[model samples]
Target: MINNVRRDLNDLPQSLRNYLGVALGGAGLVFWVIAVRESHFLNMNAYGLVSILGWPFFVGLALVAAAFTVELFRAPLRSMQLTILIVLLVLFVFGTPCAVEPVASLTSSWVHAGFIQYIVQHGHALNGYDARFSWPGGFSMGAVLVAFAGQANAIGFLRWFPLFIELSYLAPLLVIARSSGVSRRAGWLGVALFYSTNWIYQDYFSPQALNYLFFLVIIAAVFACWQPKPLASYGPQSGFWRPRLHQNRNLLTRSRWEGLDTTSTWTSAATLWVLGLIGIIMLASSMSHQLTPYVLILALGACLLTRRLGRPEMVLMITVLAFGWLSLGASDYWVGHLNVIFGSAFQVSSTIGSNVTGRLLGGLSHVLIVETRILLTGGLFLLAGVGFLRRSADSRALEVLAGVPFLVLIAQSYGGEGLQRVVLFGLPFTGLLAASAIFPLRTGAIKAILPAFSFGRFARFAKPTVRMAAFVVVLGFALATTVVRGGNDSYESFSKGEFDAVNFAYNHVRPGQTIESVNGYLPVGFRGIGSVSVTTPAQRSSTSVRRVGLRLLRDRPSEIILSQSQQLFGEEVSGYPVGWEASLESTLVNHGYIITAQWRTATVLALTG
Candidate 1:
């Protein structure tokens, strides 16, 4: 029966196949629109966006994945059709949250907006205000944009920034994928996989998002500018054994090293110009985000070691710039918090524990989401390993690039998000390698490093099996990503009511007065900079409502803003009892607090005279 279906599909005319692909993408878009219209943020539960998202969203995602897979398998692939399908898939995966939510999500996005606003208003970063402000290039750039657009603040740019930035990433990603020494089909599929599996929420409006763009552009430039020179095989013909010291020395001789060096067709002037641009981007990245510069250094070093980079000086330039900014420009951040900077260096176990184990403690739904993330990451790496064994390539550059990001895990944990960042930095290469498992080249510029595993009898059914595998893998990732990507939206995503309440508090509160909340999940910081302060007490499930009220009373904050998102966070993540916010609000009212303002999803309480 499967063979018959495959035969029928193969018999379809090229025009009909193209139409089918277009139809699938159109249907997927329609379903996605329906899903967005059907979704209600207020209805979201512990399962996060998935809880509120209906079947249409999943159907839409599946359709888009199917369309891409079908296009991927077609003879003489339709690049335009595949591009449209991938864009639709990206929309389904990344743009849904922006479309469904009332306002821009994530507290850090709002804070970053606040930083940009401060820069726009004052023309300088507020000193000693925020650790993030010490590296202010992104915020400064945003301020320039705001001025260029004649916008009063950065709020106008926040809501759809993720979608815009993600779409922007696709260009560099395409360059990287196409130039990464993979088959054209594998490169396109790898690009799709990169988007499908990118559940990391760092694309929100922040320095990291912009720096990530810089990261991609730098790597893409390197790949486009250089290709590895062909070298003779020196390793064992079979089995996993190390080469002898003499063979290794022979491999490293001046002639051999020259053979290993990368070559470029571009003129030296063009190469120097591109390198200078890359340097500027590195400088900007170093001043924009603390971590990406080091990641770039590591990536450049990986390229250099793997003979994919023509210029070795690029790595040193980034390293010096990254640390130089740390010592000079960002002194305010690391001056006193040196331990925070280097506290976890070489503490691999502790870093892993913090990055992985610490994140596992939450509600069942949250735990499931985290587990899915881990599984997705592990699954990609596992597939990449198979590809590495099966693939024929000129250089082991992809393998090195994919593996080198892990070294960042040993240096600093990046506040428990290091692992996620590592996964992201390596995702393009990892996706390519994983795709190679499905569509590996027969041969390349150099002999295979490892003996290629033969499919043997399975080779007869390879085409259909490869199609099915690609479809399953892409669709499975799309579905899983839909769940895990928005898994925190129950608390992380804000509603209009929450926004209104936060605005009310900010407007009514004085410059020196503090606004208190149970958590920092809402849109609170865009308006207030150095003058107004907001505080969220440490969340503890053991703490009673009475104790929370007592702490509020002791702190005597001028106003307290409690919202549905914060309450959901307490119940879902902190393990606090459901309606704990209400209980605490009642306790505060009974003492001396009055409900100064109220909204359907949020309330602001003020102390009564």
Candidate 2:
């Protein structure tokens, strides 16, 4: 009978096999939505040539192959786990295979965010600074972080699937969910559902999504109100700080960590400090420009509230503050210019505050408060509390509560990194809340079986190696997708101006031309390679970086130049008075600069006379 069954299995068609592989992978993707995570296997390199270009497809294939063989290359997946693995492979091939380049994407986003619009157009990065005017995407640390894993990660595999961010966020949640009565079978299913549904957005916005992932793991530390991590699994505490939420008890005694203490070699502390510094700097450079007030408030709050933030955390905070301020000093936009924004903020502070408050109240009423973003964020954790209360928990749900602080910040600064980024930090919990939704919504027929509270024991089912491999594969996919997509669309639109301008400038610059300009370059200042550059702006023009055409107006510079955003200063020139017409002719003759080309998306009019 066994031989007959084996023969029957062998008779399946090749198409069927391929279909099964992808089918299972898609199921795995859905499973991620149910639990806001990924837990399965795929023969990542199953496809040969395709593996070189689209590794996410290959990784999914590899998982499927491993499942059939029953050998633990990473870890053997259970039958259900194998089903989910195959499905993701299908999705990657048919759905997410196309990609774009990097510089173009970063440049486009910078422009959309209203940053360095005119300057980045004509600027190129040389070492740390832009010699031309502005380096939109240079090789500096800021550039590196942006190009390689800031929001639009360009760094190889990590950005391919946002792995670093996902692994960090999901692992702790998975561990926590299992402890809170998620059966080994059910808990694993939840993870699969979570990944497929919510977190896919990370492929586009890294900082908002990644930071939230980090925030979720920290929140899980709160569930440990009593001993047992989540009510009775036992063991030493994990993470640097045994960070209890505002009023929680010290469930894990220090003595419990003796084994961890041994592994806590001196090198670990120094390593952590160094890593913290780098991470903070990267965060500051990539996203922390306006220096949100919340950061200052959070730092103080964190210092006072959490015991986990020992001397080391203090050191990290100080490091972040000092370095962040220094970056401000270095940039052209912020140096002595912050008063413009704050002054405006202070003026309408009351009105903006009122508008934001109304939105928050409206969101609370609908339960769809996070439709656009945080509410829309992929990974989230549902407190096992609802289940514990009902005697049988259902799916995980979003904590509308966290949105309060975020809503409050809209009055000060509007979009992106300001308050939205910080509010987004709470979004990873969506998965946890999702799990609660999965098990038992008393209203749904599905709930009859999936009890609300299982009180399941905490189990470390996935070993470190398994986790590490899974993380690598997920991140690899997210990073790759981001690089390709951000490029094809964004770059061209953002730099259409600068690219044209550079070509014209090269053709126009003469060996001994004296150029006068009403406005200076971005990232500020330029040296004369062949044309003497007079950097200044508006009416108050000086020869140095301060004034574009001032010194030239007094003396006879062979030519004059004019740019938008600053005043037309060279009204008085050799042939005539430096009004708009003389300013134009003078700049054309003197700087050898003329408007050669123009674009709708960018202000870049290629100039060469």
Candidate 3:
């Protein structure tokens, strides 16, 4: 009877259906299927430490959910600005505690926001630290955003900032996806699942999530430009002089089983305007001698292979590729390497490995699966791609969708060659891979065409018993994972105890009082503090660390960790293979730094006078 009711409600208007989805999603958040068995009273101290990060993350994300909900009620792009205002309100009221992280990473946007940070914090932009470039004559958006974040921190704008930034990605994605005939539900679900995937951790969770949020809008300009000259859709006169704003609606209009009636002059013109704007951005990226052009280049290539490339694509592709070929590597090195082999005409890059550039390839071994693993993971993607191909859906869309993962492979292999390498390579790949799975999860056009139908039949809403059972299953799963990972509450971030040490170090130390951790905790712990240490990976010999510490700290560190349970009890540090356990033990004993409090694996030390 309940299933019958849910089927009946499925045909409700999207606004009503979406509201229902939000309520159900909220319920899922509250009563997920995996957690259960422990009383709520089990971890009392943890409730107190909620301020450390978790609740803020959930709240901030909840605000994001609210913002998406607002977007859902409004159809198309007619009322974007007003919807954004509503989104802003939700964040300010509900999400406030996420501001604690910026103090550590110097998470300002001004530097990353512009040329000043490029020149000062990192000097290589002038002479191409990542590549061999000159000054960044072009605009510096990252530097600007960093500066804004710094300002936001001062004025206590942390809560709304995350929501603002996340929506940057959300808005454009909605505009594009909805216009393209994809269901609003699928589009929102696509962005949510893709953005929240494990692979997006570096972006969505980090300060850089801002960049990921805004970048596609920037890239979309290129796509807009590449679209074909606008033809008319409605009538004879309607086909002329149209702005590209409405152009995408051509490709994105929701269709029944019948195919679209093509070629409208006004509609085409508007679509091309959008495409043209994208093209201009692409050209500008090429001209800037910055990361955008390279990204545009690789993106364009993949775009072409997937059929996303349109008429303007040919000219854009050729021009960028030619300019890129000219600017690659220093003239002298390329000439010398090439002259040595093919009389100077065959200019090749000076790299350590033949196919994989040595510097770039260095990181590949870390992520690169050997033949067996490659065949497995890559094969899965390839098979997924094949399945996508077999679908009779829009060939171009499928092609573009499949090509995103392929592009990641290219970047992962050869083109992770610039400062924007992470943005250039990582962002699109994660989004593409995540979005690709949507097709696989709800297979077949018939089912994909249907909306989610929980509000069916006599039991339009779930019975309390059903809800409780679902809740227990989800609660149990979450509890099980938490237990397996050694009760590490945060599956995504460092624990409260780990974060606590930084505040402990910061407040405890006097201004200008020097400190050191024999282990290189400098980056995470001493964000705003003035300090120095010579901790390098290669020279971290037991003797070298103590000597370096003693020399740098000018005698002995007033405070040091002779033993601090290897960064997270048993979890692995960024690059190191061993968890906290394999952290250096002998090196601490050799140093005069005396152990004080020994809690679990942590041992705080203070130097003896």
Task: State which candidate, 1 or 3, has the greater TM-score.
Answer: 1
Question: All candidates' TM-scores?
Answer: 0.95, 0.40, 0.50
Tens digits of lDDT, candidate 2, 182-297: 44333443454344333233332233343344334333432221112122223555543342121133324452222111122235566466446544543443343333323323
lDDT of 1 at 401: 92
TM accuracy, model 3:
0.50
* Alpha-carbon runs more than 4 Å astray in model 2: 1-23, 26-103, 106-139, 142-419, 439-609
Q: Tens-digit lDDT track for model 1 on 216-319?
A: 99999999988877654564554334432322343455543343477885899999899889989999999999889998988988787666788877888899
Ranking according to TM-score, highest score first: 1, 3, 2
Q: What are the per-model C-alpha RMSD values against the true structure?
A: 2.2, 15.1, 11.8
Models ranked on lDDT: 1, 3, 2
Clashing pairs in 1: none
lDDT of 3: 0.36
Instruction: State the lDDT of candidate 3 residue by residue for 1-609, as single tens digits.
Output: 646644675567766864553454444334221111111212322111132333433343443444344343345523443344323322222122122222122212212232344433553344422222321323243334446566422223322344455555656655444433243443443344333321211222223343343346644433333322223344333322333233334554332111222222236667667656655544444434433344445555454433345443444654654355445523322443443222422223322132233322112322231222223333334533543433223324434533443343333223323212332243333333333433323432212223333546645354433433322322232222222212111112222343355435545556555445444432233233123222223233233333444453454555554223234212222333333222344444455555554444234555555
What's each prediction's clash count?
A: 0, 109, 65
After aligning candidate 2 to the native by TM-score, how far in Å is the CA of 262 from where it should be? 17
Stronger candidate by lDDT (2 vs 3)? 3
